[model samples]
Target: MTSASMISPGDILTRAEIRPILGGSAYGGICPAIEERNVILYSDHEVAKKFGYHDGWLSENDTLGPIFEYTGAGKSGHQSLTQSGNKAILQHVQSGRTLHVFTRVGKITGTDTKTHRYIGEFAIDEEQPFVPRQGLGEDDLIRTAIVFRLRPTGEFDRSDSDTISPAPSTSAEFVPLTITSDMLEAAAVTRNAFTSSSLRSRSNSASLDAAASGKIAPVQAVNVSEFQRAASAATTVRRRKALLIEAYVNQLEAQGHSVGSFQLQIEGRTTTLRTDFFDATDYTLYEAQGSSDRDAVRAAFSRLLDYRRYVRHDGLQYEPKTVALLPGRPDPDLEALLASYRISLIYQGEDGKFSSAF
Candidate 1:
């Protein structure tokens, strides 16, 4: 095996030359050369497609720069961080190992040699190292996968064919819930599915059984259209806030007032933050908190401060009044904090009426 110094960026090499020069397996997506003090990553778009994933590409330019998303090592089932290759990549900074990346270009004709184009070095993004995504595995079953965010350390190959489009914004329109028997039944089922510990235990047991029997467990496929509906059915704090907004919007409509929400898409960011509710009749922007805790109260205040800048009324000359919406009244200190900023507080009383405090 030759020394690691032979490999350089933009150099094309075959599988046989990699092991002798890099000191790692010449196969697999992740190759860790311990003696070489290098962690080599290979991004093969063709192989990824077989597993129902399209990875190993650069994203559209953002504030920081374009980031490369590389799928972690796992061909089937759930990809765990505990694996050796993933662990090595995760702790590369602390371990003092350099990361080298390569992408498959093509193979030589009439032979068994595969060609790879070295794409320079990279480091994991400190803000968000990796993201958990759901995709089909090699077995064609849904599984959780890990995608690592890598930032370039130096000049690297940038090609239009290797760049990916920006991800879709996460924005949802408000949905009014109707009080019907079937709707109640569906809600009850969803609540049990989320909160019941026994159900979770049974699910774990079923997974084990499937593994023992060499059978893959069935799971729902990813569908963008049903994302909001599935999110609303969860028993999370966000879900509770959605319900609160729905109730308040209904009340405003009953009083012959127009109400809706605002979707704000900030530049240089992929996510779109949506306000809880906006009263078009009176030009008031509402930010809802699921709980009256201090943290939730503080976050609601911060969001209101940010959202008010873009919120506008067509005919009004003044800015919209900012109000914090909660399920119940907060402590005196929290209320004082909101009042100091000149932000109003609105809570639902036990009798199901909205009470405002300023």
Candidate 2:
């Protein structure tokens, strides 16, 4: 249908349909100015179509005065009902406006293992709006919720015409490369190599101790105190190394970066010593490692006689917050599209307080 036929001259049309035609032209595109002049002309077009008015067009001759009058009177009636003894009834109807839309998509029916028999059919409510009424009795206001079921037919058109068109493509643009299994496998191998190296270092020291014990049967008396001190130091070093690696991984993950392999740099090493890393991009590696260290230290320090009293004890607490900033207000086209869905901006707030300018 022609735009003129769909929207008559001097008749109201949504701001969305007229903006594009007037934006760059002489009419300097004042949004608020246009909205005030427009009145929503179409209502129950789908209902009209189902009752044999297939075109879904309303001529000037169509009597819409009664329907508009009913809506106006209903609003006044609701107010009057509230002021009178029927305040309960008014409240009942007021409650209906707050009813939420519940939608279920793709509900599949089936049996777990046995063959399931399909029932004949059942009535399904599509766009059900809650309506409230008063019951017959003093102080007895009844709110009866009714669901209106709409059968599938060629009546209502649910297509939205204002959806944004995708950007045009050029032949020179690079196509996205697909990640293959081989790439992931290679990454896994790299991680495993680091882990193996760390394990070997730890095992070699243990083996050396065992070999020394085997060679010296009834060995020369070495200081038991020295042996214990060395062993404790080695354990501490290993624990610290593990904690640092974990912390690094957690930090990277928290920043939305995937943890690949941990690289350790010794005092004079040119190459980074690789170690196995956990793959968790949703958390911070540094923070995780810090938390782990804090817990471990707290446990270890509690056993120490001299150092335990000096260590400041604090409970673990970690919270991450993210803030996003936009360049400007929402696009005019986008705002208009959202308004068609009956959504309105109620308030805009700053970091703490509400602002009326928005």
Candidate 3:
């Protein structure tokens, strides 16, 4: 409502947050130089070249490198984005989520007499908010704030020749050597003899019977069903519920949707997971695309059967019947349009694991 809150410092950025900054568009068209410029600065010159910034603007190149590349102009008419401008853009994107800013300072050596110092800094913001233009109200504003910094490094000699010269040669030189098969065979024989002698000594000193000592007992085989029963009984139901919710969140994130909240309805049980995230706020469940709900359900059930086989448990299994459910409508048989995946529901009892019963 109040444009969320500013992203707090010290938060680790997630893939969702990094995606937009790396290249995702906020309006309609892509930001031309931003992506290429970032690639040049953070990645290799080749990568930047792929994006059309081939001049090595951020690296070894003199005039076109990142150090000399102007992002935003200063008040003095220089074309370089101020530290504040970069921060603002990042913050605007974050929409008050958690963000992390990293700054580093290093020295660059030059081949000539003149030396220069520079700074390197970057920021990663998480869970930024986004509202569609169609959803905007007269007073409702879309704000993006970027949290970033400028890291100034120490100065080093900056000679034009330094850029052209190759890296300094190491003091020690490695020499190539060749060995014959006979030498290898002799070494292998000596190693085998030592190993044989060690084995012989151990065998001579060891007793065969348990009472005499040095006797190793064979491990007993465990009953698979019994182990599964014990494992299921020991697991906490609450933890399973948490896992289910986490799986949903991860799935949505993978689909490029920022999940804000989710409601899990299990009969009379209702659980909700909420966040002030951007993008999708509601969703409808559907069966996998191009598959019937019954078939989709069967596939999910098959996976459950495979899981049972893995745990060595035997039981009569039933496939879950899946359907599409909108906000308020009868479940539909249209499964061909929805994405589907298996999600564990819970460890219902000692003998079985419960999963999405849909």
Ranking by TM-score: 1, 3, 2
lDDT values of the candidates? 0.64, 0.22, 0.23
Full candidate order by lDDT, most accurate first: 1, 3, 2
Model 3 regions lying over 4 Å from their true place: 1-105, 108-326, 335-358
The estimated TM-scores of all candidates read: 0.51, 0.13, 0.16
User: Could you tell me the TM-score of candidate 3?
Assistant: 0.16
Candidate 1: tens digits of C-alpha lDDT, residues 1-358: 4364576777888777776766568678888888878898888888888987666555455588868888887889877555678767866775667788888889999876788887878988754566555557999986656677788887787665566544454323321111111111122213222222322344423422232222222111112233334444323454445446656776888999877556554554443345656788877888887778898899999998888876766656566899999989999999999999879999988887889876
Q: After superposition, how far is residue 281 of candidate 3 from its true place, in Å?
A: 24
Q: Is 1 or 2 the stronger prediction by TM-score?
A: 1
The model with the greatest TM-score is 1
Model 2 ranges with Cα > 4 A deviation: 1-229, 232-237, 240-259, 262-278, 287-358
What is the lDDT, from 0 to 100, of the residue 89 in candidate 3? 33
Task: Report the candidate with higher lDDT, 1 versus 3.
Answer: 1
Pitting candidate 2 against candidate 3, the one with the higher lDDT is 3
Score residue 317 of candidate 3 by CA lDDT.
Answer: 33
